[model samples]
Target: MLNIGVLVSGGGTNLQALIDAQKSGIIHSGRIVTVVSNKPGVYALTRAENAGIDAHVITKKECGSSDAFDAALCAYLQKMQVDVVVLAGFLAILGDSFLLVYKDRILNVHPSLIPSFCGDGFYGLKVHRAALDYGVKVTGATVHFVNEITDGGKIILQKAVDVLEEDTPETLQKRVMEEAEWKILPEAVELVCSGKVHV
Candidate 1:
């Protein structure tokens, strides 16, 4: 079985999806063994605690530098023997050290289809807002490996969600999460864990 570690900064709705997927046996070969949050008192930690998963905190300010935080994160993940790292709404910028150590082992779920409203300054509702502002007929989610470039990783899975005429950023975000992010993220994890994904 692949031991998974999740990094979070917010509500962790995607982390919940992974937990639920494991419980349902949908994720056949991977299990979320730890959840590390960048912020304290976030609902994501609560979610992790309620599920009986080990949870921790590593605030950037506490680490004193981004590099230190990234190094600490790498050490923690290695100590836990984590085989896969999932970025489930994790907001902190992990330094190159973490990326090099984990390589293709780290997975990230982006709110929009890549090569679109992704990269720096495009996160959370901003992604959905960009899609709406551009009046795209379809906006979806992408699950990919974590590389040095933000959202510029090898695509594992993608699912498209239709945009409604009256859709707001909030509504579009919800729809993408429900129809795409929630589904493909776990599926991608399962694929990696099962040794089906080549890289």
Candidate 2:
């Protein structure tokens, strides 16, 4: 089984999805071994604790620099023998050291259909708001490999959701999470763990 290490910064809805998926056997050949959050008191850590998984908080203020923080995070994952690193709402920017160490072993779930409402500055509600503002008929989520450039990673899977005129960013975000993000993130993890996914 692949040892999965999840990184989170906020609510951890995606992390919950992975946990549920693993429990349901939707994510085969892998299990969440640890959860790391940059901020303390985040609900994600609570979820991990409730699930009896080892959870950690490594605040950036203590790390001194972004590179240092990334290195520290990578070290923790390596120590845990993590086979896959999933960025589930993890807001920290990982540097070259981390990226090079993890390489295609790292994955991220973006809230948009990628190449649209993605890249720098497009996160959380901002992605949905941009999609609504652009008047796009459909918007969804993308699961991709993590690379040097933000959200510029190679795409693994994408699932689209229809846009409704009455939808707000909050509603749209929820829809995308349910219809796309939550579903695919675990599947992508499974694919990688099962050796079906190629870099």
Roughly what TM-score does model 2 have, to 2 decimal places?
A: 0.98
Instruction: Residues 1-199, candidate 1: write the lDDT tens digits.
Output: 9899999999999999999999999998989999999999899999999999999998888989999899888899899999999999999888898999998999999988888899999999999989999989988999999999989889999898999999999999999999999999999999999999947
Off by over 4 Å in 2: none
Choose the strongest candidate by lDDT. Answer: 2
In the predicted model 1, the residue pairs found to clash are none
User: TM-score for each prediction?
Assistant: 0.98, 0.98
Candidate 2 lDDT over 69-140, as tens digits, reads 988888899999998999999998898888999889999999999899998889999999999999999999
Q: Give the 10-residue window scoring lowest on summed lDDT in candidate 2.
A: 65-74
